[model samples]
Structures are given as structure tokens and as C-alpha cells.
Target: MEVKGKVVVVIGAGKSGMAAAQFLASHGSRVYLNDIKTRENLEERSLHNLEKMGITLLLGAHGDIAGLQPDLVIVSPGVPLTIPPVAEARERNIPVWSEMELASRFTKAPMVVVTGTNGKTTTTALIGQIMEDAGFKTFVGGNIGVPFISEAEQLQPQDVAILEASSFQLETTESFKPFISLILNITPDHIDWHGSLEGYIKAKAKIFARQDEKDWLILNGDDRETRALAGLAKAKVLFFSRKHILEEGICVENGYLVVKLEGKTVPVIKPEEIFIKGSHNLENALAAVGAGWLMGVSAESLERSLRTFPGVPHRLEPVLNIDGVRYINDSKGTNPDASIKALEAYPDPIILIAGGKSKGSDFTSFAEMIKDRVKALVLVGQAAGEIEEAVKKTGYYNYYRVETFKDAVYKARDLANQGDIVLLSPACASFDMFRSYEHRGEVFKELVHELAKND
Candidate 1:
């Protein structure tokens, strides 16, 4: 935790890395920020600002890690551990910590961390709201837009730090233990980055690596992969399920979200009363309620937050209803499983906009669901052909392959009827066409708004 005079190397000049560099420099650590990208690829102002703070910028290559002889290495979530510099640091026995790991060392606050293949953002945000509504000073960050290090140092013991941990971040974690941890659900995702499905699951399991009996670990009881990891936690394990009633833990029973712990059944809220719809969102709400309850949040506060929280922006967010046709933006559905859940949320005829940068996901199941749920499919980006092929194998031919993102939206609009839903759930990543999933959702919303004006 003492970085007063240590030489530190922060890898990947992204948001998390920049925060880490600035944080370290402010704390008197001699920081060197490195990236595989050249100086031209990054923003000029950000680079100059880092230099102004006395943090050294090492761009273009990572070979400088050896020459700098850093005592500690901080890794951004997006940077793979197989990178030469990271492996070299391990080989040389230099301490390597994730940005989350580095951030956790500075905070004495009770942390509530959420991790899984899906629903992490919504679950984390919901938990933050519940804590805040309960009158607790809360800081919410991590993989959910803001870096944890940016707010970690400022969190007091009485404050709460609610973080959304990604597999990428958890894989590099050393001493990042949360007071409460929730594994919402695990599925095959980010295989290209994690090397395999088993590897991805291992990274997710790291969320509870350092927790003890004092901590609480929550798992999704409905998810097979997540339920199988119950024995790995050293902390007390709690399960949340939407499909089954549990003897202990949170679950939906007889139209109510209830927590049954220690032979006491506490009815929290009704699923119909929650602002966020869908089985996945219901599961997220259950996990949030469990975390909030474990952290001493009142039942009234949890229900109030769940009733009013308007869900995350990019996940099944309602955009506009033009001519009785609902247009939805679910751009955060970056995997086939997420898109499948999005499809399951609605019963209306759907004109689904899918296909983006493939994350090595098997689309056969997604394609099968599209055959039954989707009225029409408009595909775009790098994975169009692959998705189309999968759909074809399922004997679903009501699909159009568009050349551009704008065209895909326009085509979906044309195909949708007044009673139908036009949904933007890519089921893949957005890096093929846009900067990030947020950018992709913003553009979809803008296009939908523009279409309304034109109509």
C-alpha cells in the first residue's frame, strides 16, 4: 500500500490506466504509463496532462518496462496478461496488480462488488442506489464507466464502494476482496481475451478470492455454472434465484421478491412493481436486494430504490414510441446470451438489429431464438455473415444484411409494423464500427430520434 517512493509502471493508456497513473503520481509514486499504441493513437491533451502531473508516458511499445525497473505494475482491465511486459514482470518477480487491486488497498470502506457475464452494470448501479437511498455515502465505479482508483482513496470507512468487476479486471486481482460479492450469472463471453471458457470462469471466481467468513458471497441459483462455484467461496454464500423458491436467500415466490434467511421470510417487493422488466433484470434486482440487505440496508429502502431506478441506459432501455411502434436500445447486449435474454423480455413482434464484432460466441442458440421471436432481423458489422449463416441453419430466412449501421436501423424501421418493436441488440461487441457499446447506443438513440422527426 505504500507507494511513496516506489517506481510503478501502469499498462494500457486507457481510462483505468490514466486514473491509476494520476492516482499513483499524486501519492508520490514515480509512475510510468505505458501503452502498445503510439502517441498518435491517443488523445493529445490526455498525454500532455499526464506529463504535467510528472507521470512518465511510455507509448508505442512496452519494452520500456524492463528498462524502467518498476517495483510495481498496474494493469488496466483491457490489457491481457499474456502481453510480453506483464509476463516479463511476473518472470522478474515484480509485483503486478490490477487497477482494482491497487484501488482496494487505499479504501477501508465496505465494498460490494458484482461480477458475471451479464447484468453487472445494472446490478451494481441498483446496489449503489439502494445504499444511497438508505442514507449511506456511496461511491459506485470500477468497470461501470469510472475507475475504482479515482474514488477509492476518498472513500471513508462509513461509505460504501459498489463496483462492477469484469473478468478482465478480476483476472489480475491479487488482494481485491469485497465485503459483499455477487456473481449474477456466468456464461461464455470474452473467450478471445480470456483464452477459453474455463479461463473466463476462473477469472470471475477471483472476485471472492481473498474474502473471509466475515464477508458475504452471493450467487445466482438459477445459473448452473454460477451455482457450481458455491464451494469455492470462503465467505458466507447466499443464492438469488428467479425461477425457484429457496429455503435461504433471495427468490421470487408467489408474485413477490422475498428473502428467506434464518427461518424468517421477508417480502421485499413484487416483480411487477420493479421498473426494470425481463427475467434477467429480475435476477439482477434479486442480487441487488440481497447485497443491500447484507449491507444493512432497510427493506423499505431496497423496495423504494428498485421501484424507481430506471435501469441502465444501454440495457433494454426504452427510446421512443412512434406511431405505436416501440423502439428499444439494448446495445449492451454484447453477447448472444444477452441478446437471447433481451428477446425473451418482450412478446411483441420484433424487428431485431443484431450483428457486430463477434467475441467468438456460438450464435446457433441465439439464431434459434430469433427464428421464434424475431419478425425480422437486420444485420450489420463484422459478424453479419456469420449470424446470417447461423440463422439460415435454423431455417429462419427473414433477415437482411446491411452494409452500414445507419442502414441497419433504417431497414429495421421499415420492417417494423405499428404493433411491433424495433430493438437494437447487437449480440456482439461494438469495436468493429464504434468506439464502445456506449457510443453504439448513443448513435442508435440519435438515429431513432431522427427517424421520429422524419416520420
Candidate 2:
């Protein structure tokens, strides 16, 4: 882990990559930060700051790792390993590590890593809150915004690091093993990046690949793909389910969130009492409860956190009610399955704002759900035509396609009637229209608030 005066190459100029480069340079590594994007395409302030810090910037093309002969390469999660420079590094026997892996090498804290297709953010945040309420110092970051490397060196052994491990982050891990690894549920997502569903699942499995008997792996018993991974885990497996009562994991029993593990039954809280609603959030709560209980958190602390956790901003978040029509921001629904879950959360007739950058997701199921639940659909961004076709194939013709994101929001508002819901739950990535899902959600909220001003 000592990197004094070693040549290191860091790929991607995004948040994680910049953080990794800064961290490595501060540790006295000769760092070369590279990105295929030109300096014009990236954040000028951040790139200028990196250059000022003495880290060499290689923009507009991939870095020549073979020419540099670096000791190690740290890759941002968004950069695929198949990129020539990374692959070349591997061919030359250079150690390639993910930002998550590199960060782990510097931290002594017991890590609680959460990974899955849909609920990782909510579950990771909840676990951090629960641990903090139980009097443990916590550092929460990974894919949830801040890079783990930014805070890795600051954590002590008694502190806990709650991380949201994405498939992209887990795939490049070499020795990154969390003390507690939770797989919320596995669904078809990021297929374009991983090449296939199997490949994505394989990446997610890396979260616990290095764990031994003393560690824990939490799975969702309700998901077949997630449950099947239990046989492959060397760590002790714990399952959380929303569909059925589990004999030895976490589940709902008699309207209460219950945990039956290690020959003990602990009723955590009532589902209705929890701040976040929806069946998906219930599963997230069960997983968070498992992490907290396993960490020896008191039932009182768990209940307090669960009751007060106001839920994440972009997932099923309420914006404002305009003339009895509620507007919801679920911009984190970056895939069809996530949007489907968002659709299921509401019983009101919906004017759904969907469509963004395609992620190779099949929209038939999402379309079917919309046919049953949505009163009207307002599509925008890159995948609008595809989603509209899928909706048409489902025999649901109450749909409109818009050119701009603002237009889509205004159209949804116009279509929504009293007691109806206007939901911004695009079933695709937000890169086509905004910087990220958070940006997309923020714009949606602003537009909704603008509508409220006129009301």
C-alpha cells in the first residue's frame, strides 16, 4: 500500500477518478490522470486544480500506459476494463485496481458494502444512519456521491464505512472485501456496460469474493438471481425478503419487520411506522435492519433511525401538490425495473414522465405496468421513441412524446387531473439530458416548483 515515488496511472476524469488521483498524488505517487474527453468537455475548474496539484493530465485520448510503465493503474467505475489502456496494463502484468479497491487498502474501518440493481443507495444511507444512531462513527460514500478514497484515510478501526457498491465498481476489485456485504436484489441493469446480464451479476458477486467465514453476505431471498449467489459465498449468508417470511433472515411478519437469525427473533418495527413507503423500501429496510442488528445495534436505535430517515431525495420523493395533483421525483429510476417499482408505489392515476438515455433495457414490462397504472405518459430524451413503441405494443395509446425535458414536465402537469400523480421516473439513464440522475431530479423539482408558483 506504500506508494512513495511510484508511477501510477488513473483512468477517467470524473469525480471518482479525480479523487483517486488526488489521493495517490498526496501519498507521493507520480500520478498521470487520463480521460478520453477533451479539456473542453470536462469541468474546467476541477481539471485546472488537478494540473495545479502536479498530477499530469492526459486528455482527448487514452493514456499510453505501456509507454508510461506505471506501477499501478486505478480505474474509475464508469471506465470499462476492456478499454485498450486498461487491457494493455493487464497484459503487461501491471496491477489494475478499482477506486473502491484502492480506497479499501488505506482504510482500517469495517466496511458495510451494499450492492444491487435498484435499492443500493437507499439501503446504504439507511445503514449509515442506523450505525451513527448506535454511537459508531460512520463514513458513508462509494457510488452515492463522494468517493470512498476521499474519506478512506480518515476512518479508524472502530468506525464503519457504509458504501453503495455498483456493478461497475465491484468488477475491478482484486482484494476489496467488506466485513458486511449486502446484495439487495439483482435485476437486468447496466447491460450495455457489462455486455450481458451474467457479466453484471458476476461483477456484483465480487463484493464478497475475498470475504472469509467471519464476514457476512446479505441477499434478497425474494430474487432468484440474488438467492442463488448464496451457494457461492464463503461468508455467512443472510437473506432478506419482502414476499415471504424467512426462517432465518429478515422479513415482514404480522405487519412488522422481523429478523430471525442466530436462534433469536427480533421484531424491528412496523412497516407503516417506517418513514419510507413502498414494497421496495420495505425490502431495503429489511436489509438495513440486518446490517444494523448484525453490527450489534440496539433495537431502540434501529427503530429511531428507521422512523426518522426521510428517504433519499430522488427515489419516490415528493415535490409539491398542485391543485390536488401530486408530483413525484423518482429520477433514480434509471432502468425499466426501477421505473416499474416506482409505478407500483402509487395507487393514483399517473401522468408519467419517462425516457432518457437507453441502457439496453426491455421496456415491455414497464409498458405493461404503465398500461395498468398510468393515465397518460409523457416521454422525452433519447429513449422516448423506444418507450413509446413499447407502450403502443402494449395497446396503451395515451402517450405523448416531447422534445425537451422542461416540455415533458409541463406536459405531464397539463395531463394530470385532480388526485392524479405526475411522476418523473425515467426508465433510462440521465446522461442524455442532464449530468446525472441527481441533476435530472433537481431540474424536475425546479420545474414542479415553478408550476406551484403559478398555482
Candidate 3:
């Protein structure tokens, strides 16, 4: 933990890496910030600012780690350990730590870590809000938006660090333990990045890897993959399910978010009172409520926070209504399971705008899953042909293929009838044609607003 004057190499000058560099430099560490992209591709102002802080920027290539003889190497979530520089550093016995790991060494606050394929953002944000409303100083970040390193040094003992941990972030983490850990649900995602489903699951399981019996692990009882992970955790296990009442943990019983702990049943809140829509969101609510209860947050505070959290944008946010047609932007549905849940949220006939950069997901069943609910399907991005093939197998002919976001949005609008919903729930990542899912959702909203102007 003594970082002063120690040489450290930080990889990938993205948000996490940049924050890690800034933090290390502030702590008096000699930090070399590296990114794969050349200096020409980067903003000169940002690099100059880092240079002013005594942090060196090594752009275009991961420069000479062995030559630098650094005391430690810090990696961003986007860069895998399999990369030559990181792998070489490992062989040389230099400690290669993730931003999460380094930040945890400085953070004095008790952490609440949330991980899952679908609901991590919603659950993490809700838990952070619940704690804040209960009058605790809370820092919410990790995979959601802000980097944990950015706020680690300022965290107080009484503060709560709520992190939305992802598989990528968890991969390089070693000693990043949390007071409470919640795994919302595990489904196959990031297959290309992880190389396999099992690899992805192993990375996510690391969220509870360093915990002892004193810590708590909240899991999804309904998901076989998440439920199966209970046996691996040394921490106390609690479950949240939507299907059946559990002997312990939280579940939906007669439309209320109820908890059964120590053989006593307690009602948290009615599902109707939860501001977020869908059964998937109900599952998220149960997880947050259970975590809050464990932290001794009053039931009243939990209910109030759940009813007013206002949901994370791009995760099934309704943008604008053109005439009677409703447009929903679920751009956060970056995998098949998430999109499947988005489809389940609507009862009205849907004109779904889907497909993006493929995540090696099997869209074979995607079309079948939405055959009854989706009136028309508009495909975009790299996976359009793959999705078209899947739709053909379902014998659903009302599908269109478009090349860009503009085409997809207009096509969906044209296909949607009065009282119908046009959902932008791409069952893939946004990297093919857009920068991020937020960018894709913004474009969809802009197009929808244009339609409104025309009306």
C-alpha cells in the first residue's frame, strides 16, 4: 500500500485507467498512463493536464513495462490480462492489480458490490440511493459510470461505497472484498471477451471470492447459474426470487416485496409502488430491499427510495409519444436475456428495433420468444443478418433490415400502429455503429422527437 515514489504502469487510458493514473499520481506514485491508441488519436489537452500532474502518458502502445522496472502495474477493465504486457508483468512477479483492487486499498468505507448480467445498474443505483436517503455519505460507481479510484481517497469510514461490478472489472481483482455482495442473475454474456460462458461466470464469482463468513452474498434464486454459485461463497448467502417464496431472503408474495429472515416474514413494498416497470425490475427491487434490510436501513426508507429512484436511463426509458405510438429506449439490453426481459415488460404489440454488434449470443430463440408479442421487427448493426435468419426460422415474415440507426428508427415508427410500442432493445452491444449504448439510445430518442415534430 506504500505507493509514494514507486513506479507504476497503468494500462488503457480510458475512464478507469485515467482515474487510476490520477489517483496514483496524487498519492505520489510515478505513474505511466498507456493506451493502445496513438498520441495523435488522443486529446492533447487531457494528456497535457496529466503531464502537469507529473503523470507520464505512453500512448499508441503498452510501452516497456519490464524496462521501466515498475513496482506495480494497474490495468483497466477493458484490457485483458492475456495481453502481452500484462502477461509479461505477471511472469516477472510484478503485482498487476485492477483499478478496483487498487481503489479498495485506499477506500475505508464498507462496500456494497452488485453484479449480474441484467439488473446491476438498477440494483446498484437503488441501493446507493437507499443508503443516501437513510443519511449515509455514499459513493456510487465502479461499472456504472464513475471510476471507484476517482472517489476512493476521499471515502470516510462511515461512508458506503456502492459498486456495480462487471465481469471485466472482477477479472483482474484479487482482494476487492465487500461488506455485502449481490449477484442479480447470471446469463451468458461477453462470450467473446471471456472466451467462454464458464470463464465469464468465474470472473463474476470473484465478487465474493475474497469474502469470509462475516460478509454477505445475495444471489438470485430463480437463475440456475446464479443460484449454483451459492455453494462457492464462504460468505452468508441470501436469495431474491420472483417465482416462489423463499425460506430466507426476498421474494414476491401476493404482489409485495417480502423478506423472510430468521423465520420471520416482513413486507417491504408493493410491486405497484416500485417506480420501475417489469418483473425483472421487481427482482432488482427485491435484491436492493434485502441488502438495505441487512444494512439496517429502515423499511420506510427502502420503500421511499424504490418509489423515487427514477430508474437508470436507456434501460427501458420511454422517450416520446408520437401520436398514440409509444417509443421505449432499452438500449441497455446488450444481450439476449436482457432483451428477452424487455420484451416481457410490454403487453402492447411491439415493433422492436434490435440487433447490434454481436456478442456471440445465440439469437436462434430470440425471434420465437417475441413471435406473439412483437408485431414487427427492425434489425440494425452487425447482427442484422443473424437475427433475420432467426426470425425466418420462427416463420415471422414482418421483419425489416436497415443499415443505420436513422433507418431502424424510422422503419420502426412506420411499422408501429396506434397504441403499439416501438422498443429500441438491441440484443447486442452498440460498438458496431455507435460509441456506446447511451449514444444509440440518444439517437433513437432524437429520431422519435423528430417524428413528434413532423406530427
TM-score of each: 0.98, 0.98, 0.98
Off by over 4 Å in 2: none
Residue-level lDDT tens digits of model 3 in 214-323:
99999999999999999999999999889988878899787788888998888878999899989999988899998899888988888899889899999999898888
What is candidate 1's lDDT per residue for 271-314, written digit by digit as tens? 99999889889999999999999988878888999999989999
Error of 2 at 242 (Å): 1.1
- Candidate 3 positional error at 338, Å: 0.5
TM-score of 2: 0.98
- Model 3 residue 442 distance off true place after TM-score fit, in angstroms: 1.3
Q: What is the C-alpha lDDT profile of model 2 across 1-455, one tens digit per residue? A: 68889999999898899999999989999999999999999999998888888999999999567799999999998888888999999998899888999999999999999999999999999999999889999999999879999999999999999999999899888989899999988889989999999999999999999999999999999999999999999999999888998889998888889889878888889999999999899989999999999999988889999999989989999999999999999999999999999999988898999999999999989999999999999999999999999999989999999999999989998898999999999999999989899999999999999999977
Candidate 3 C-alpha error for residue 56, in Å: 1.3
Candidate 3 regions with alpha-carbon error over 4 angstroms: none
Q: After aligning candidate 3 to the native by TM-score, how far in Å is the CA of 26 from where it should be?
A: 1.2
Better of 2 and 3 by lDDT: 2
Write down the lDDT of every candidate, Cα atoms only.
Answer: 0.93, 0.93, 0.90
In candidate 1, the residue pairs with backbone N, CA or C atoms under 3 Å apart (3 or more residues apart, or in different chains) clash, namely none
